[model samples]
Target: MFLTPYVERLPYPSRTVQRAIGVAAVVTQAGIGVTGSVVRVTGSGLGCSTWPQCQPGSMVPVDHAQYQTVTQWIEFGNRLLTFVLFVAAVAAVLAAWRIVLDHPSRRRLVKLAWTLPGGIVLQAVVGGMTVLAKLEWWTVAIHFLVSTPLVWLAVLLLRAFNEGDEPPRPVVPPLARKLLVPLVVLMWLVLAAGTTVSGAGPHGGDPGTHRFQAPIETLAQIHGGLLVAYLVVLATFGLALMRGPVPAEVWRRYGAVWAVALAQGLLGSVQYALGVPEVLVALHVLGSALVIIATAALWCGSRDRGAPVSGTPAPRESGELTPAR
Candidate 1:
C-alpha cells in the first residue's frame, strides 16, 4: 500500500531513467548470485584465504600456480559483484530519498529503497564472516537467503518506478488462502533442500570456504524427490487455473513459474545423474536464482480480485475494479 501511493506520485523520466537504474540493480545482484555459484563450483571460497582483502599484502595474487587462474577469477568476480551491488544500493537509496520527501505515494518506495543498502551492508559483513569462518553452511545459507529479499525489494522498486499515477483503488480484495500460496512456499523449501544437498556434496562451495560438508547422494535424492513434489503441485495449480476465475496476469505468472520449474528440474537431473560437471552445476544454480526472481515477481503482481472476467464472469467486486475518484 505504501509503495502503491509512491508509484502513483513519482515523476517519470523521459529516458526510462528509473527503469534503467532498476534493471541495472537486478542485473548486478544476479551477477553476484552467479559469482557465488562459481565460488562454490571451483572450490575457491578460500582462494584469498581472507576477506575485506584477499590477503594481508595483496588484493590479487601475482604468482600462484597452486590455485588455477580461472579459480582466482571466479572468487574475485564474486568480490567485484559486491562492489557493483554497493553502488546500485547507493543509487537506489538516493532516488528513494528524493521521492519520499515530496510525494505521498512514493514515501514507502523511498523507505524500501533505503532498506536495500542496510541489507547490503549486513550482507557484506556476513560475507566476510563466511570467509573468515571458513564457509560455514548455516552462514552460507543465511547469506544466500538474505539476497532474495533485497532482490524482491529491487523488483518492487522497478515496478513502482514504471507504474503511472492513478487514484487509489476503491477496494482491494482479500488474498485467498489457496494452494498457490502453499505451492510457492514449497518451491522455497525445495530450494533450501537443494542447498543442503549441495553442502553435502564434494562440490558444495569450499568446506573451509563455508561450514558445509561433502554432499551425500542420499540427501541429494531427497532434495530431488522434493523437486518432483514441487512439480506435482505446480501441475495441479495449472489445472486449477483452467477451472477457476483466475486473472490473465495470474495465468501468465502460473505459466512462467511452471516453465522455470520444469527447466530447473531437467537441469538438476542432468547435473546430478551425469556425474555433475561444473558447467551444468553452474547453470543449475543460475536457473534456481531465476526461478526465485520470477516467483517473487509473480507473487507480487497477483491479486485476489480485479478486472472484467473474459467469459464466465468474475464475482461482483465493488472496489478498485470500479472507477476511482
Candidate 2:
C-alpha cells in the first residue's frame, strides 16, 4: 500500500515530502469547500440532476433541453473534484503510515490522517443526499458544516507533522491557557449561526428550493453579535499575550487569528449592508475556511511540540502551564 517500492526505502517519508502532502491535503480540502459555494451561487446544485449518476441511467451527462450545458458541466465538474480530494486524502494516510506505526508519539498523526479519508467518505454520502433532496437548505447546511471541522482537522494534521512527537506541552500561562478552547467553541457557534443565516437567505441552490422560516436579518444580527463577542475575546487575549511573557511565536499566531477574525467580521458587515451579494457570499465562504484554520493554527502554536526523547521546548523556561489535547 505504501509507495516506496519504486524509490528509496526510508524509515518514513522525508519531512519535506510529508510536508508537501500536508499542504496538498489542505488545499484540496479548501478547494472542495470553495467549489461547493460555486455550486450554490450558480444554482447548479443539481446540474447532474440525480444521485450516484449524472442522469437516471448514465454516469455521464445526457443532452436535455431543460438542463443547460454550462450548468451541467459546472455541477458534474464539482463532482469530479471529489475524486481529486479522495486521492489527496489517501496519499496523506500512506505518506505518514510508517512513522505512525513505529513511534509512540507519532501515532497521533495517523489518527488525524485517517480523518481525511473518512471525512471524504462522509462528505460523499452527504453530497448524495443534497442531490436526492434537491438541495434542501438543511442538507446543504450540513454539507457546508461538515467541511468546516475537516478544515480544522486538516490544519491540525499539518501542525502535527511539524510539531514533532513532544509530550503535549502548552506554552501559554494558565491565565491565558484557559481562553483557547472557548475560542474554538465560539468559532463553531459562529459557523452554525452563519449557516443558519445562509439557509434563510436568497441563495437556495435551486430557484424553487425551500428555505428556513427564520428571519435572515434576525439570524444575521445574532451571527454578527456572536462574531463581535468572539473578536472581543480574541482581542483581549491578544493584548494579554502582548503584555505578558508569552513566546514570540504565540504572539504572531494570535495576531493572525485577530487579523482573520477582523477581516471576516468586516466582510459580514459589507455583505449584509449590500444585501448579501452572491460574490460576497462566496467570499464569506472562503473567509470562513480561513477563520477556522487561523483559530486552529493559533492554538497549535501554543503547543510546545518537540521530539519526545529530547522534549526540550523553550516555553517551559517561562513556567507556563503545559496543556495537551
Candidate 3:
C-alpha cells in the first residue's frame, strides 16, 4: 500500500482496459479522412495557402482578403485533427507497453502501434509540402493513401489487444488459409485504384489544382473492375467457408464482409452516376473505411481461434463462456 504512489500501475485483466482508446484511433483516423474529403469537395484545399502557420506572419489564421473564414476553418480544423490522432496513438502505445512481457508474440503489434506517432509526423510534413505545391494531385493522394494503411495497422493493434495474452493458433487449416492473404492484397489494390480515381476526379483539393489526365469515366471503370475482382475473390472464399462445417461466427463475419463490400460498390456506382455530389463523396470516403474494417475483421478472425471464437459452437445457456477474442 505504501509503494502505491511510487509504482506505475497497469490496468487489471490487461485485455479489456481502455480498449475504447485503441478503437477511437480507428474512428478518428477515418474521421480525418472524411473531413479531408470535405475540404477537397468544398474547394477549400488551399484555404490556408500556407502551412505550419495558417498564413504569413501568423501561426494562427487571420482573416485575409484572399482566404475566407469558412474555408480557412475547414482546412485548419481538419489539420488540427492530427493532434487528436496523436493523443489516441499515445494512449495505444502506453497500453501496448504494459502487455509486452505478457504477450511477447505481440511485440510486432506494439511496434506497429508505436509507428502511429511517427506516421503522424510524416503526415504533417507531407501536408506542408502539399500546401507549398498548391495541393497537387499526387501529394494530396499520397497523403490520403498513407492514412489508409495506418488505419489497417491500428486494426491489427486492436485485434491483438483484444486477444490479450493468449498465444495465437490457427483458427482454420494451415493449407486452406493461404487464400486470405491474396484476397487482402486485392482489397488494398482496389483501394489504391479508388484513390487514383479520386485524384483524377473533379475534386483535386483546389479549383486550380492539376488533375490526373485520365477521363473520369475511364478512372471509374478501372476502379470498378478492380473492385469487382476483389469482390469475386472474397465471395469465392466465403463460399468455400460455407461449404465446410465452420463455426457460426465465421459465417456471420463472412455475411457482414459481403454486405459491406456490396454497400461500398453501390455507393461508388451512385456517386459516379450522380457526378460525385459532395455529400455522397464524403459518404463514399466513410464507406472506404467500412470496407477496410470488414476485411480486417474477416482476416483477423481467420488467423487464430486461440481459445474459441469465430468458428466455435455457441455455448449452451447452462454453461459459462468467456470470450475467445
Candidate 4:
C-alpha cells in the first residue's frame, strides 16, 4: 500500500509512446531469431563453449584455441542481443502498465504486456539449453520454433494497444474467418518442415554437431510440398475474403502476407539451388521472420476490437493527467 501513491504519481505514457514500444518489442523478437540463424550458418553455436557464460568462469568471449575469434564474437554478439530483447520487452510492459483505461482494458493490456518479458525469459532458458546440448539439431529447432508464437503474441500486443478489451469480431465473412484456422495450421507445419530440412542440411552450427539422420533431398522435397500447400490455402483464403465485404485494411494486410509468402518461396528455391550459401541462409531466416510478422498482422486485421476506452487519462506537457482521445 505504501507504493500506491508513488505508482499513481508516475507519468502516463502517450499512445504514441505505447505503440512505439510495441513495435520495438516485435522487431527485437524477430531480429534475434535472424541473428541466431547467422550464428548457426557461421558455425559459431559453441563459440562460448558454455551457456550463460562465454567460457569457463568468463561471461564474455575469450581467446580459445578450439573456436575462431570471429566465431566467438558472433556467438557472443547474438547472446548480447538477448539483453536488448529483454529491454524492449520490459519497456513494453511498463508502457502497457501506464495506459489509463477501465479496469478490464487495463488488466488485459497489463497481462498481455507481461507475456513479452515472460517469453524472453523462457527463450533465454531454452537458449542456454541449446548451447549446453552442444548445438543439437532438435534443440536448435526448438529454439527457433519457440520464437514463432512469441512473434505472433507480440503482434497481438501491438494490436491491443489501439483496441478496446472487447472480444474480437470478424471483419471477414464467417467462412473466411474459419479458413484462417487451416491457414494458420499450415503455416506452423511449413515452419516445422523447414526446420526439419535445416536439421538435415549441411549447416549444423558446428562441424561436430550431429545432423538429423535423413536425406537432405527428401527433407527438402517435404518442406517444399508443405510450402506449396500453405500457398494454396492462403490463396483460397484471399479469394474468400475478396468475395465478401471486407475492410480495406484487412485486404492490405492479407496482401502483404501473400507477397511475403511468395518472396519467401522464391528465396527458398534460390537458396536450395545455390547449395544453401551462408548469406542466403541468413536472408532466408529474415524472410521467415517477415512471414511470421505479416501473418500475425493479417490475423489481427481480420478481427475488430472496437476502439480504445474513452475518458482515459494521458499525461500532458504540464505533467498533469488529461483525457486521451
What is the Å distance of residue 258 in model 4 from its true position? 0.8
Candidate 3, residue 269: Cα displacement in angstroms equals 0.7
Tell me the spans in candidate 2 whose CA falls farther than 4 Å from its real position: 1-12, 101-105, 308-325
The whole-model C-alpha lDDT of candidate 1 against the native structure comes to 0.67
Q: Over the stretch 132-215, how does candidate 2's per-residue lDDT look in tens digits? A: 999899999999999887888999888877777657787777656778878788899999999899999888878878899988
RMSD of each: 8.5, 7.2, 6.8, 3.1
Tens digit of per-residue lDDT, candidate 4, span 1-325 = 3533444555656678778988988899899999999999999999889989899989988888877889999999999999999999887776665563323356677888899889989999999999999989999999999988888888888888878878888889887898888888989999999998999889989989998998989998988999899898888888898778999999899889989999999999999999999999999988988998999898889988788762256324784543332
lDDT of each: 0.67, 0.81, 0.76, 0.85
Query: What lDDT would candidate 2 get against the real structure?
Result: 0.81
- Please tell me which model should have the higher lDDT, number 1 or number 4: 4
Off by over 4 Å in 4: 1-7, 100-104, 310-325
Task: Kindly indicate the candidate among 2 and 3 with the higher TM-score.
Answer: 2
Q: Is candidate 2 or candidate 4 better by lDDT?
A: 4
Clashes of 4: 0
Which regions of candidate 3 deviate over 4 angstroms?
1-15, 101-106, 164-167, 173-176, 305-325
By lDDT rank, best first, the candidates go 4, 2, 3, 1
What is the Cα root-mean-square deviation between model 2 and the actual structure?
7.2
Model 4 lDDT-worst window of ten? 97-106
